[model samples]
Target: MTQRHIIRRVRGVDTSDGAGVKLKRVIGQPALDTLDPFLLLDEFRSDEAGDYIEGFPEHPHRGFETVTYMLAGRMRHKDNHGNTGDLGPGSVQWMTAGRGILHSEMPRQEEGLMWGFQLWVNLPAADKMTAPRYQDIDPSAIPVVHPATGVTARVIAGELAGVEGAVRGVATAPVYLDLSLEPHAAFDVPLPEGHAGFAYVFDGASAQVAGQELARGDLGAFSRIGDTVSLRAGDAATRLLIVAARPLDEPVARYGPFVMNTPEQIHEAIADFRAGKF
Candidate 1:
C-alpha cells in the first residue's frame, strides 16, 4: 500500500468570471491546465457586494458537468428547461450539461460574505452529447463521517468508510470530499488504481503531505500510482477539498463554455449556440 505524495503544486490565480465576479482560478488557468476528468476549479470568496452582486448571467454549456458547492450565502439558479433551485449554505448542485443547456446563477443576497466553489468536470466522448441532468443535494442530505478522532469528512460524491455519497451513477466515477482536520490530525484514504487525485487547501495555516507543505490556496496533485493519500494538519485546524476521478484520456477541444472531442465538434457547437440551439 504505497502512499501518494504531492507530485505538483499550483497556486490559485485571482481572476474574474461570470459577470465580473472575482474568484480564484485553481485549475484551467495558465499555471495549471485541466486535470483529466476535472477541468476547472474556482473559489469565490468575497464580502463586498460589488464583487458578486452581478453574479453569473444566463450562459450555455455543452459536454461537461458543473458542480456548485456553497459554504456561505445563497444562490438562485434557473435553467431554460424550467428547472429552478436555491443553493444555501452547505448545499451542493451537480449539473451535467451533457449535450447543451442554458442556465443562470445569481446571488440571492444583497450583501454579506459569499463563499463557494464551482468545479467543472469533463464528460467522456461517449457521454458528451447525452441529455443534460442535475442532482441538487441539500445540506442535510450530505453524509458527514468521522474517519479519525480529530477529522470530519463530508462525503459529496463517491464513498467513504462504506458510506456512499449523495451523488452517484456518473460517467466518470469521482470522489469529492470536504475534510476538516484539527491540529496535528491526520487523514488517510485509499484511492482507486489509475485515478487522478487532487487536494486544495482552503482554510487553516497549512497541510502536510509526504513531508511537503501545502499552504492555503495551494492545490496539490497526487501521484497516479499510489493507492493511498495521507494528509496531516499543521498547528491550526485545516479545511480542504479532496477530489479524485477516473481519467477519460481523450482529446479535448474547448471554446469558452463548449467542450468537445475535436475542433470540428467545437465549430459545430458554436454554430448550434448561435442558431438558438442550446
Candidate 2:
C-alpha cells in the first residue's frame, strides 16, 4: 500500500468568532482556503471566561454539515427544530444543516479551561437541500481503541480496525479520530483511495506524519497519491485530530454562514432566513 505524505502545512491564525469567542482558524484561513469536502476547522481553547462566555449566539446554517468535538468544558446547544443537548468532555455533536437551521451553542460553566474544535464538511449538491439532522453523541458512546503500543484513538466517525464509530449515514463517508500518542509511538491508518485526508496537531511539541514533523497548531494535508497514513510521535507526547472524507468535487459558493453551489442560492438562503423560513 502507498503511504500518504504531507503536501502542505498551514499554521493556524488567531481569530474571533461568535460574539468575540477567541479561536484558531486553521483550514478557512487564507493560507489554505479549504480542503475538498472540508470547509473550515476552528479550535477554541481558553481558561479565561471572558474569552468564550459570549459563546455562539443564534446563527443560521445551510447546505453543509458541522462537527463539534469537545476535549474539555461543557456546552449547551439548542436549535429551532426542537432539539436541545449538552456536550461535555469527549462529546461530539454532528449537525447536518441540510436546507437550513438556526442554532446556538453556549458555555455551560462559569470558569474553567474550555477546549474544543468545530469542523465544517461540505455536502454534495444533490444532498444540500435534503433535511436537517443531528447526531448528539455522548462521551461514553464513543469507542476507544488501542491501535498500537502507547496509542489511544477515540473514534467519533468511521471505522478503526473493525470497530465502528458513533456517527453513520453521512453523505461523505468520513473518518474522524482523536488520537493520543506517547513519545516515539507510531501508528498506521488505512484510508479509502482518493479520499481527502489531514492531520492537525493540537498538543505536544511535534508529531511525525508523512515524512514531516508538524508542530503544535499545524494542520498538515496529506497527498492524494496514497491510501495509508503513517503517524509517529516525537520525543514528547502528542494529541491530534485526524480526519478523511470523500471529496464532493463540485463548485462551492460560500457566504458568511451559508454554503451553496451558486451565488443565487446563497442570496436565496439569506432572504429565507430574513423571512423567518429557517
Candidate 3:
C-alpha cells in the first residue's frame, strides 16, 4: 500500500508586504520556519480597494525568485530590466532575482476585489549571483487537465496525469498547481520523494491527505514521508493551490528582501544595494 501524506502543520493568513495589503503567510513563520528551497508563501485577498490600492512600491530583492499568480483582479509589473507586463486573472509571473533587481507591482483596477498569491523561492549558493530572468505567462498558456469527473487542475510548473506544465526549467523542480473540485470529489496526486509540499485552501472546504480538514484561508503543510497526496472537496465547490519543491538543504540567512547562505553575504548584498550596484 502507498503511504498517505499527513498534515504536519496548519497556518492562517497574516498581514504583510506593505500598508493596505492583507496577506496570509504560510511559510517563513516561526511555527514553520523555512521550507528548504521554498522560503515564503503569501496569499493576498481583499475586496476593499483601500486594502490593496497602495500596492507594492519599488523594492529591491536578491538571491531568490518570486512567483506571482493572480486569481482575480489585475497587477501591472515594471522592473528595472526593462520588463513590463500585466497579470490578469489566472496569469502567472515567475521572476528570478538571481543577483538583484528593483521592481514594483501595482494594482491596475481602481475598485473591486484583488486576490492573488506571491511565493518566494530561495536560490542555492552557487546560483545566488546569476543573471536575473523572468517568465511571464498568460492564462491561456497554462494547461488545464481534467483528472477526474469533477476535478480540474491548472498545471503551472509541474507534470500531472501525463500533462506537463508550461512554466519549466526552474532549478528547484517545483510543482505548482491550481485545483478545483466539485462537491464530494476526491483526487489523488503524486509527489516526488523528499520534496517539501503544502496546500492552501482559498475557497470552500477540503479534506487533506491525512483526513485533516482545511477551510478557506488555511494552509496545510505535509510531512516529508509520503509520496502521494489525497484531497476531497466538501459539500460545496472547492479551490486550492498545491506547491512542492526539492529541498536545497542549505543554510538560510535572510535580511528583509535579501536571502543568502551566510551573514557576510547578506551584509554584502545590503552594501551593494545601497551603492546602487544591483
Off by over 4 Å in 1: none
- Compared with the true structure, model 1 gives a TM-score of 0.99
lDDT of 2 by residue, 145-188 (tens): 99899999999999997899999999899999999999999998
Worst 10 residues of 1 by lDDT: 203-212
Q: Which regions of candidate 3 deviate over 4 angstroms?
A: none
Screening candidate 2 with a backbone cut-off below 3 angstroms (N, C-alpha, C), the clashing residue pairs are: none
lDDT per residue (tens digit) for residues 108-176 in model 1: 999999999999999999999999999999999999999998999999998998899999998889999
Report the C-alpha lDDT of model 3 over 193-227, residue by residue, as the tens digit: 77888888887775554577887777777777778
Give all TM-scores, in the order shown: 0.99, 0.99, 0.96
Cα lDDT over the full model 3:
0.86
Alpha-carbon RMSD, each predicted model: 0.8, 0.8, 1.4
How good is model 2 by TM-score? 0.99
Provide the lDDT at 101 for model 3.
97
Count of residue pairs whose backbone atoms collide, per candidate? 0, 0, 3
Better lDDT candidate (2, 3): 2
